[model samples]
Target: MKKFLIHIPLLVLSTTFTFISCTSSKNVDTNLPKDIAERPADEDSQKYEQAQLDKLKASIESESSREKCANASEWTFAPMGAKACGGPQQYIAFPKKMETTLLPRIEEYTQKVKAFNEKYNIVSDCMMIMPPTSVKCINGKAQLITAEQ
Candidate 1:
């Protein structure tokens, strides 16, 4: 009974320390996004990760092209990727019919890219990407068109 009681506090203390170690803390650079890993990915690692991202983006594209688009109202654009300076790197146009599956996957990809950018300390041009004023269908494909505001 005495040994069990004595070890209970030690176990609690050890568990508390373990939990604290795993908890996420605020990063020193408030502007920087949170990193996915403890250390930055090496060059080769970054390349491989980028390849994987390309594959994911390609899959999203393939899924987007599954249906032929006609009406502009049938299409919408989703922001893609995280720019180093903040905001999405660009936007992707897809048919609204696939919104249920496409939006979630796009979000997943965006988050992964954001984490990748943070982990690899990616640098991007601080160019502002404005949202499209409307979507247009040309050559049976959806395209985002921006009008001068």
Candidate 2:
């Protein structure tokens, strides 16, 4: 009887401690950043990726500009940017001579842009980019034109 009385208090204290511990609030780590980039790489990587893509685009454009478009036959158009909804975002004009070099890079760029769009869940206008009907050489640069133009 005497030992039971001593153990009753111990049991009550242990139960009370368990309840108190169970009810105690714990800190949850919420890594919320202000004005954060939509990407997981978070900051510099996105900018670097975009910049590299832009640089490649600029280089490809430079390749097409190496010669005057005196002959429209010497020029052709390639699709650019893989749109989310389907079709290319735009068309690029390149010299037929540079086709061997430019086509692969253009394909690479398109693939990368497609990946970026998919990765970042980038939304784009669903308007389908119709292929240019013909290449036009107004002055020196090659231009893509529709049948109406």
Candidate 3:
């Protein structure tokens, strides 16, 4: 009877641990977007492109600061590494009525960046950094939602 009581507690403890381990092992999938899985694998290329992006962003910030446009929003492209760098990234939005006045300048700046990348042969296989055409604003910041087809 004494031996049975001691074994009962041990059995309960082992059963509890087994149940906890089994339940914890089943992780829920968040179901992220397909584009996230398709990012560039080349670390060197990603770094080079990110530098070009930073320069373009600086130009845009200088230009925007002068205009002081209210509620001005733009779609910005970011490589996986750029998100880790702390600074304002340049975003180019298309010709929407809300941002019509800024479109021409943005377009010119984007073209310059494109030219620089071409001159230096800094390119990426990933579509996100290769000139994304569509974006969605999340948490008051533009996120690349789609790549150019």
RMSD of each: 16.5, 8.4, 15.8
TM-score, cand. 1 vs. native: 0.67
Error of 3 at 115 (Å): 0.8
TM-score of candidate 3 to 2 decimals:
0.30
Candidates 1 and 2, the one with greater lDDT: 1
Over 22-84, each residue of candidate 3 has an lDDT whose tens digit, in order, gives: 988787554644695465456456566657667766665554344322332543333222211
Model 3: residues with Cα > 4 Å off, grouped in runs: 1-56, 59-98, 128-149
List the candidate numbers ranked by lDDT, top first: 1, 2, 3
Report lDDT per candidate. Answer: 0.86, 0.83, 0.51
Best by lDDT: 1
Which residue segments of model 1 deviate by more than 4 Å?
1-44
Give the per-residue Cα lDDT of candidate 1 at 66. Answer: 74
Clashes of 3: 0
lDDT accuracy of residue 19 in candidate 2: 87
- Candidate 1, residue 37: how far the Cα is off, in Å: 25
> Which window of 10 residues has the lowest lDDT sum in candidate 1?
24-33
